[model samples]
Target: MSWIFLFFAGLLEIGWAIGLKYTDGFTRPAPTLFTIASMIASLALLGLALKTLPVGTAYAVWTGIGTVGTALLGVWLLGEPATATRLACIGLIVAGIVGLKLAA
Candidate 1:
């Protein structure tokens, strides 16, 4: 299930992104280890997913999902700004991801 692998890859992408925040420029050992582990896991799953999925489709979906998820996480959990323009852009990214999948 390449899509399943892609889903897990997306989740791990979120993990790695949050871990990067906690890593404090790599000064925090625990978060740094988490960052490295999550990165490995994310890449591993992405590679597996790519075995069946077209590379362009897989990559676009992976990155779109990861970016949107991470940006939302930042806004919600980390108190990052969420301007209307930013929200609109995020919506566009999601729409594009959906369009690509539809085309695929």
Candidate 2:
């Protein structure tokens, strides 16, 4: 249950992270609101997961999910570069996330 909460929290972290770009520096009202809502929900869910998960592991996993999702989305949607080295680093982050979950 805690892992489930953490997973969704991580997803919401991705939402809010990507939402920042759509918000256009808070000038866009709808995206700004969505971004704010995502931020609140993400933190709330993270708090819930923290009840059972170690802070270090949870934090790393949360940010790892966000970073990976955001980077992929940036490449797919924002026309960012998807270089091999960049992707390899992202893979390493994924490896670390998996390692942390296994350890936990």
Candidate 3:
């Protein structure tokens, strides 16, 4: 299904985002390679999903998943701040993503 592809693409978007952090300005060879690969895969999958899904909805959902996943991962794995305000903003993004899905 297109949704499935979109969902995985979103996950890959998360992968590449974290990969970017690991890249250290592309100085780290391994993480940089991983980041580039994931970035390609993510965009490819997004293109595939665009065959059926509306572009606006798909893009928002994709970035929403990436944004939420990366923020959570930053808190859990990278020791980023997890303030209530930040959490609230993430919740709003979630709501918007869900709303787009429902509208579609």
Model 1 spans with C-alpha error above 4 angstroms? none
Candidate 2's C-alpha runs over 4 A off are none
Model 2 TM-score relative to the real fold = 0.98
Expressed as tens digits, the lDDT of each residue in 27-100 for candidate 3 is 99999999999999999999999999999999999999999999999999899999999999999999999999
Query: For this target, which candidate reaches the highest TM-score against the unseen true structure?
Result: 2
Give lDDT tens digits, candidate 1, residues 1-104. 88889989988998998889999999999999989999999999999999989999989998988999999999999999999999999999999989978887
**Model 1 error, position 37 (Å):** 0.8
Task: For each candidate in the order shown, give its overall lDDT on alpha carbons.
Answer: 0.92, 0.96, 0.96
Query: How close is every model to the real structure, measured as TM-score?
Result: 0.94, 0.98, 0.97
Clashing pairs in 3: none
Q: Is candidate 1 or candidate 3 better by lDDT?
A: 3
lDDT of 2 by residue, 54-78 (tens): 9999999999999999999999999
Better of 1 and 2 by TM-score: 2
Which model, 2 or 3, shows the larger TM-score? Answer: 2
Superposed model 3: Cα runs more than 4 Å off = none
Model 3 earns a TM-score of: 0.97
lDDT at position 80, candidate 2: 100
